[model samples]
Target: MPQNRPRRPKVLCLDDEPAVVEGITRTLRKLYDVTGCTKGTEALAVLEADPGFAVVLSDMRMPEMNGAEFLAKARELAPDATRMLLTGQTDLDAAIAAINEGQIFRFLTKPCPPPTLRGAMAAAVAQHRLVTGERVLLQKTLRGSVEVMMEVLGLVSPTYFGRTTRLRHLAADLATALGHPAVWQIEVAAMLSQLGYVVLAPEIAEKVYYGRILDQRERAEVERAWVQAAEMLAPIPRLEPILWIVRNVRRTAADMAHQPGASPDLVRAARILRVAMDFDELLADGRTSAQLAIDTLRGREGHYDEDVLDALEALRGGGQRSRVAEVPVGALAPGMILVEDLALASGMLLVARGYEVTERLLARISGYPADALATDTVRVVLPREQAEAA
Candidate 1:
C-alpha cells in the first residue's frame, strides 16, 4: 500500500452508533481524513484541535448536546467548515433550529446510503470552495478597478476629480456603521458616479466646477452625457453592471435636478458627490473657506439630500479631516504653500499634500496681501523639514 496518497480533505462524522461511525469511516477513509466521534463533546474537542475539517456531519439527537448546539459551536470555531445534520427523528422544529441556529449547510436522514453521503459531502465541499473563491475574486477585482478608475479620472481632470473618492469613503464608513448592505452599492456608485463627466466638454466641466448657474441648454447637454457615457461603456462586458449603476445615478440626479423624490440611496450618493465636487470648485475659484460649508448647505434647498447634508455636517464635526490647505491673501504664489486649511464651499479639501503649484494658482496668490500669510501655510517647493518645522 502506498504510505501516502495526495492530500485529502479532513471530515468529522459525529454519531452515537458505533456501527454507523465504523461504516462511514470505512467508506470514506480512502477519499478523506475521516474522524468518528461518539459524543458531541468529543467531536468539539477534536474540531478545536484540528479545525481543517471541511465538512462536519453530526447526529441530530446526541445525548449531552443536540446537533443544533454542536453545529452552532462548530460554525463559530471553524466558520469555513460545511455543517450537515443527520437524524432518524422527523422533528421539523429540530431541523429548522439546526438550520437557523447552527447554520447547517445540509440535512440528511439516518440510514443514509454510502453513495448519498459521499455525494452530499463532496457537494458541500465544492460549494464552500466556489463561494470562498468568488468572494475573494470579487473583492480583489472591485478594489483594483476602483483604484485604476480613480487614478485615470484624476489624471484626466485633476481639478474637479477626487470628490467621489471622499464621498465614497464617507458613505462606506457610514454604511458599515449602520450595518447596511446598500452601502456597498452606494460606495461603488460613488466611485463611478462621475464617469459621465468624461463625455462632457471642458467648458461644461468648468461651469459645473465653478458653480456657475448652467443655462437650460448647458443643463440638457450635461444631462445627455450620462446616457452617452452608459452607451460608450455598454459594449465592454466587464463594465456592463457598472454602466447600469451609472445610468441610474444620472437618472436620479436628473430627476432631482428640477424635481425631487428618487431612490433614497441614489439621492444620497448624488448629493454627497454633488457637494464634494462643488467643494473642489470653490477651492479652485478662491471662495472663502471659513463659511463655504454653511453656504453650500444653505444653497441645497431642492438639489441635495438632506440626510447627506447631515452626514457632511457630522463629517466636519467628526474626525473626517480633509488634507487641503488654506493660504492667506498675501502668501499665495506659484509653488508657494497654502497656510490655511481651506474647506471648499462643497466640503472638499483644497491644499492636499503633493499638490503642485501652477501658473493660474500663482496668479491667484499674487492678488492676496504679501504680509497676510495664513498661519502654517507655505509653498509646496520648500524643504520638507522647513515646511514641517515652520
Candidate 2:
C-alpha cells in the first residue's frame, strides 16, 4: 500500500510585473503550491474565493494598490494567513509603513537571493500554522466551556436559560435576515446573555422575564449581574467580540457604534441581540403575538436599530406561515418550532415555546426518562417543505 504525502501549503504572490510573480512562484513551487496574480484586486478575489492560502506575498509598489493596502485587505479576508512584502530598496519606507499597518509579517528587498526568499516563506508558513492551530484550539475550548456553563445555568434556573434559547433563535434569525457575518458569535452571545441572572433569585429573574417592575434594590442586583457576567468571561481567549455583544446587548445601535473598538460586525450582533431580547421580553409579558411585540418596540422610538427590527419583522412574518402539528417527543425533528413549552410532569421546563428543535436539543431530550414529559404530545410548527411532504 502506498501512503499519501502531506499536502503542500498554498502561497499567493501578487506583483504588477508578471516576471516578478513568476520568479517568486518558481522559487517557492517545490515547497508550496503557488498562485500568482498581476493585480491586487485579482489577488484579493482569489483570497475571498479560497481563504486557505497559508501565505500572501505582495510587492510594495503596485499600480492597482500599494502593498500596505493589499496586505491589510488580505488580512481581513484571511486573518490567519501570514503576509509578506517584497519591495525595492527605494520603497523600503513603504514596506515599513505596511509593517506599521500590522499587516506585514516580513518584508524582503528586491533582488533577494532564492535562499533568503525561500527561508522567509518557510517561516511565514510556520507562522500561519501557529495562528490557525491556536484558533482551532481556542474555539473548541471556548465552545466546550460555554456548553458546560449553559448546562449549569439551566440546572440552576431553567426559566431564565430557557429564555436564552428563545433569544438565541431570534438573534440567529435576525442575523441571517440582515446578511450579517459572524452569526455564530451573535448566537453564542445570545446563549450566554443571561449569565448575570444567576445572581438573582429565581423568582426575581422570573419577575424580570415577565416584565414586572423591580424595586430599586432588585434593579441594582440586576446591574451587578451584568458586570459579574462580563468579569467572569473576560479572561477567555477570542471572546472579546462575544463579550462586546453581551455587554451592549441592550444599548442602542448608535450608542454602541460610537464606543471604543466598535466594528460593524460587533455593532450588528449587539443590535440583533438587543432586538431579539427585547422582543422576547414583550412576548413573555403576555403580548398576544410577535406582531404586537414588534409594534410595541416600534412605538419606543430610537430604542432599537431599525434595520434589526425590520429583519425581525420579516422573519416573524415568514414563521407565522409554518403549519402547526402535534407530535410525540420521539417524533420531534430539527427545523420544527415548538408552539408550547416542553416541561416535565413535575412542571420543570426542558425547552421553551417558540424554540426551534436542534440536533443538540434533541440529544438532551433523549436523556429524559420515558415518562418525564407532562404530555406525550406537544404542539409544533413544521417547516413549509416538511408540511408539504406530510
Candidate 3:
C-alpha cells in the first residue's frame, strides 16, 4: 500500500455523524493529512489553533451551525483556505447558500463514492495552492522590484529618498503593529513616497524638504508631479494596487477613511504612507527630533488619523538611541547601515541615514578620493554579531 506523505497539505473534515467523519478521513488520509471532527465548532477550533488546514469540508444540516455558517466562520479565520460543502441530494437550498454565502469552491451530495470524494478534495487543494502561491509571488516579486527602484533612486536622488529608509521601517512597523494584511504594499509605498522628486529641480526639492513655502507655480508643479508618479508607476506589473494606495495618499485622513474610491486596505495603506511622508519631511526640517515631530503632528487636529497616531506613539515607545559607532570610510563594509546623512564636499547629500551600505556604494566612496569622503570617519549601526566582534 502507498503510504501517506507526511508533508501533504492538511485538510479538515466536519460532519455531525462520527461514521461520516470517519469515512471522509479514511478516504482522504492517503493523499492528505486529514483531521476528522464530529461538530462544526470543533472544526472551527482546529482552524483557529493551527490555521494550516488548506481545505475545509463541512457537511450541511449540522445541529449546532449549518455548513454555510461554519464555512463563513472558517473564511473569516483563514481567508486562504478553500471551503467545500457536502450536502444531501435534496438540500438544493443548502448547497446554493454554501456557494453564494460561504463562497465554497465545490459542493457534493451525501454518499459520494471514494473516487468522487478524492477528485473533489484534489480540486479544493489545487484552489488553495493557487491563492496562497499568488499571494507569495506578489509579496516577494513586487516588493523586490519596488526596492530595486528605490535603491536606484536613493543613489541618484539621495536627498529626496535617503530619509525614506527610516520612513519605510517606521511605516512597516506601524502596519505590522496594527495587523495590516497588505503590509508589504504599505512599506513599498512608504519607500516610494518621495518618488515625485525625480521630476522636481534640486532647488525646488530642497524647498519642499525644508518646509519652505513654495511659489504658486512651484507648488503647482510639485502637485502635478506627485500625481504623475502614480500614472508612471501604474504600468508595472503587480504595482497597480500599490499605486492605487499611492495616488490616494494626497487625500485627507477623512477622505481616505470614507471615500468611495478607496477600499479599506487602500485607506490603511494611504494613511500609513501619508503619515510616513509627513513625518519624514518634519524630521528633515531639523526643527525637532523624531519624537518631537510626532508630538507636533499629534497636536495638529485633522492632520492624521487617531489610529495612525497611536501606532506612531507605539513606535516611539523605543526612544531614539544612537547605537552606531564612528568608523573611517575605508572601514565601511557592505552590510553596515549608515547612522547619519553622508554629504559630498559640495554639501550635496549623497546618501540618507539608515541606508545599508552596498558594494555599489562602497565603489562610489572609493571613487571619491576627496578628503571629506575617503579619509573622514562616518557613523554606522552594526548588527549584533558585528558589534560584539568589534
RMSD values, in order shown: 10.7, 3.7, 3.1
Better of 1 and 2 by TM-score: 2
Candidate 2 vs candidate 3, lDDT winner: 2
Candidate 1's residue-wise lDDT over 1-390, tens digit each? 687856788889999888889999998898888999999889999988877788998999978999999999998677778899989989999999999999988899988998998899899888777766775677568756776766556556654344555446555665554434345555776667666676788789767755688999989988887778667667764554444456654344656444333454455545555554454445544455625764665585765556655655565556444333444434444544332333344444443333344465456445545444333344334434445655
Order of all candidates by TM-score, from best down to worst?
3, 2, 1
Badly placed stretches (over 4 Å) of model 3 are 1-6, 257-261, 319-322, 370-375, 384-390
Q: In model 2, which runs have C-alpha deviations exceeding 4 angstroms?
A: 1-7, 90-92, 176-181, 215-217, 235-238, 257-264, 285-287, 319-324, 330-337, 344-351, 354-373, 381-389
Per-residue CA lDDT of model 2 for 55-115, tens digit only, reads 9998888888888999999988987899998888576567678998746888788887999
Q: Rate the local accuracy (lDDT) of all candidates.
A: 0.66, 0.85, 0.81
For candidate 1, which ten residues in a row score worst on lDDT? 336-345
For model 2, where is the 10-residue window of minimal lDDT?
87-96
User: Each model's TM-score, in the order given?
Assistant: 0.50, 0.83, 0.88
As for candidate 3, its clashing pairs are none
Error of 1 at 16 (Å): 16
Worst 10 residues of 3 by lDDT: 314-323
